[model samples]
Target: MSTFLNLLVYGLADGAILALAALGFVLIYKATSVINFAQGEFLLVGAYMFYTAFVVLGLPLVAAVLVGVVVATLIGVLVERFILRPMIGEDPISIIMVTIGLSMLLKALVQMFYGTSPKSQPAILPRSSVEFLGATVPLNRLLVILIAAVVLTAFTIFFRRSRHGIAMRAVADDQQAAMTMGISVRRIFALAWVLAAVSALIAGVLLADISAVDQNLAGFGLMVFPVVILGGLDSVPGTIVGGLIIGLLTQFVSGYQDPGLATVVPYVVLVLILLVRPYGLFGETRIERV
Candidate 1:
């Protein structure tokens, strides 16, 4: 029983991280229809930037996070404006290839600047644990969950209430109509990219605390695909719930299944969901008649 509780708590924590990362991915996809393959690289860059500011430059933790987020957001905006915007209305295949190329470029750039070695992040939180539901939970894990909840709630409100958020939604619904209504589709795209970067920075910093920061940090970006698809591409709430489901399912499978089966658990779940729902749990349905 203790072990089960421990796994559940830990799984939830891990899911929180995954969900945060997926939130950025979903935001970019929803607003601009651009599948950013470089999303993970943006995260890697932000994490490393935070580490450099906090650890090497001796800046305050809060200040470092702010700077890192700003830098990451700028990087995101520049990439969209210079690289992606130029290819707008081009073949989807061409856009995809360009993003793939950009991802590779960012990876190489990170390696050149940060080197291939991993760096340990300075601990921002004190080492501690608390007992909850008859299980010992790390304070850091609990903090991660709380932070993710706050960020998710804030984003939901932004989309529902804020002017910029409404504009983004309009653009997503129909670019032509949005442009005709005096909304700048280009500006909305830029805004989406910037927001995605800020979200990635937060996730990266939190993740760096849990583990070492290195190139491998970006690989976690791949995990977002399953979470977003499971929850439904455009559903923000679905992203959070789907992330938890995948996180818990992965942990349970790893705990009970043969080692090999554990590795493929996510794919198994994704395949099953795709087969049944096709559009996903909350994905928008499209009806076509010819």
Candidate 2:
């Protein structure tokens, strides 16, 4: 039916953003084994930066994107070097606590500067509607979907072909072995954070284009945990799968049933995944011969 098709298109479009956001979480977890609860704040930072650049300074969109990325990457690197680095040997709980603290601190800072009020983003991309298979759709949404696909493909190739990407894989597999092979584990950790931050920037910009830019944009990162878990925390490409699955499921349910179901579906799926397949669909399985 046309209605089903409409929901499907919208779902796929939204999934693209989910995949982008979850990729950041996966990158940090895969490389450094550190869970970054502050990842959402990075999105907050990106959205604000884009707002300042595009709306306030009236810079060109491309220039604004570059500015957001640079600033976000710098913040990520700083967090790794100054905050996370000092707790390298600390227990996992301590690290998690630190991340929580960092998130709160970042949120407070963002509030102080940007305030709690939501700001509608300027339409950087062209504003137009197009018909797709009997469904009316926004051109911006289509562009976002295309951009997400391109970015995902490019990163997949980078991970498979690039030296640093290979190095990251090596570290993720075995830190000791990677170091033995002359790979700097510390450097790779920093790179993971940088990549994570950059991913957040892209997600933030795309999301702002779709919705209002606000502090609540930070919550988008929470939606990513389910995607990461469902796709496999260590699997890079699985992000797309998980993102699509969740995005489609939420949209489909909300479209067919009650709108309230949309927000609850991801969490329900998350719990089920935790109960049934905690390792996730594409997550690597390891066995220890005792």
lDDT of 2: 0.87
Taking the tens digit of each residue's C-alpha lDDT, what string does model 2 give over 19-95?
98889889988987888888788888888988998888888888988898898889889989999999999999999
lDDT of 1 at 207: 81
lDDT of 1 by residue, 155-267 (tens): 99999999999999999898999989999998999998888888888888888887778888888777787888899887788789988888788877777676577557778
Extract clashing residue pairs from model 1.
none
Give stretches of model 1 more than 4 Å off.
258-260, 287-290
Question: Would you estimate the TM-scores of all the predictions?
Answer: 0.95, 0.96
* Cα error, candidate 1, residue 169 (Å): 0.6
Error of 1 at 116 (Å): 1.2
> Model 1: what TM-score?
0.95
